[model samples]
Target: MMEDTPSPIDRHITGLTGKARPRICYLATPSGDLPAHLDKFHAAYGDLGCETSHLAFFRQPDARSILVSDFRARLLEQDAIFVGGGNTKSALAVWREWGLDTVLKEAWGSGVLLAGMSAGAMCWFEAGLTDSFWGSAYRPLDCLGLLPGGCAVHYSSDSKRRETLHAAQQTRSIPSSIAIDDFAAVMYVGTSINTVVSWRTGSTAYQTYCKGGTVIETALSAKQISV
Candidate 1:
């Protein structure tokens, strides 16, 4: 979620681009290209002196004006890509259909910093515990596989998330994973976690896996990035 003002996490992300004025592109596909969400993104990043832009799939005003090639070109030109949180299942389906998944992988390989929250964060991993099924219990959903292992978002706020993730690991439904609480994020360089950072005090991430026929949750040391 985006704050009313640029948060420390936001600054950290911008800094990762290693540009004085990074070209940041927001993808709101998970949220169905919600206008309000796009507004929030611009409001936050714009203030940070970022060259901000967003790609909207669901509500493209001039769909005819933007071709698939145009989308590809625009995305490749960005210094960073920020995905928004929403329905992971649906988002992946759309990305696959539009071949944006491949484009994203290429972008990452080219060193364009990829980041997001919740569903956005989950999309980068091999699989994730998702509530995208609506009425059904949280299930492990396959994701982009840009990063290895599984992911669990909203680990603290959503009580069922931790339970479902643990069960998935215990049953070998998904591999050893990381569970991230709100206001916290894990930074990965290649396939390994470089560090964990949190914008909220006491909010952190965890390494979850099944060991010796039991589920173990080990808290990852998080550096406070909050101002």
Candidate 2:
């Protein structure tokens, strides 16, 4: 349906999966496993010639007859896993309960493409700022640490996020890390960042770290992506 529109970002993700037709899973656990969140993922990537599935932890128990082990087995089949954005703290809590955290770590080691935005992105790093607790107040939390250091997504869109992350850096609460603007993503190969991509023309990425008791933010070049 969206064949007419070019998808540089999806293409980039697919490439990481190392498959011509990657089997992708949309995980909306961070969004409390919302149905609409999964629907949007299908709308975005369904026409991209990839096999797509959704993992609804909350609804699946009541909606289907399946074992958690069986679900874990299915996850191993995916070539790429795209986690959706929402409450990072809540999502991690549930993921730990179901052992998806270990499964994901295995997937990453086995070369499955792990990608997402905001909360999803933060989960891949050691730590990042999140507003999941206390409403809109951004606080630092230790995360999955798949990648080294921390991350701040929607960098330019949220003012508090920027301020809080900088403060974290200054106080050495978090290590040097990547901060990506809305519509921008940082691609990592293993633990190293490969490139920064943005869907919008003016979007950008930043490298933030503490230096001499001060926070240093260096602007990184961003490549524009289609669709």
Candidate 3:
């Protein structure tokens, strides 16, 4: 059921998909949250001689048993997974309700390559920038905590977004967070981290947390988000 779609995310993780080294793939969801961000993902894997297995719909494989069986198990077959950027809570809810959390964790911890962006990446951090939206309906929830404590996605300057980040700071307490400037990514390659730029990439911005004063912009290196 993989279809062609456009992409808003810079597809930063794609640059690292080792072509010669094949691996199993698990592309994350909210495929709808985003409109057309699948084509790039597919092409990345195509270069690697791998394909993205959809875990989004497997949550309900069949009211008629028409989509085959054991769909969740099939997601675990790949060597790597690509988690898409979407609403963190919504995305995690699907996986938790469908049991993909246990599935992916076991798979990744046991060596399933974890490749993700936005919500996918945010899932790894401790506190996510959930309040950067124009609405005030949802509160903070526990993310997957797969990465360092502070970081956010599509984090940048714009009238609406700036206000959102400010509010997120006041309410959510994301003392320090990251801004992925439209076309940049702070890639995590184990303890050794770096940045990957593409398109109209801007510098990766970091807002550090101080005790009571304004948040400090400690060091805005392109890739050094962590200390």
Query: What TM-score goes with each of the models?
Result: 0.95, 0.91, 0.68
Per-residue lDDT of candidate 2, residues 1-227 (tens digit): 11235557777787667777789888888888787666667767777778888777777643322346576777777888888889898889898888889999988998888998778999999997888895767888888889999888888987888899988888888889899887678989999989988877778889998889888899999888674
Please report the candidate that would top TM-score against the real structure: 1
Cα-lDDT of candidate 1: 0.88
What alpha-carbon RMSD in Å does predicted model 3 have with respect to the real structure? 5.9
**Would you list the clashing residue pairs of candidate 3?**
6-36, 6-37, 7-36, 7-37, 24-78, 24-79, 24-80, 26-81, 124-146, 124-147
Report the lDDT tens digits of candidate 1 across residue range 8-122: 8888999898999999988888899888888888878888889988877788544212344578888888999999999999999999999899999999999899999989999
Who is ahead in TM-score, 2 or 3? 2
| Candidate 3 residue runs with Cα over 4 Å from true position | 1-21, 24-28, 32-40, 58-77, 131-141, 157-159, 170-172, 191-201, 223-227
Whole-model Cα lDDT per candidate? 0.88, 0.81, 0.53
Best-to-worst order by lDDT is 1, 2, 3
**lDDT: which is higher, 1 or 2?**
1
Models sorted by TM-score, best on top: 1, 2, 3
- Native-to-model Cα distance after best TM-score fit, residue 140 in candidate 3, in Å: 4.2
Error of 3 at 209 (Å): 1.9
Clashes of 1: 0
* Structure candidate 2, residue pairs in collision: none
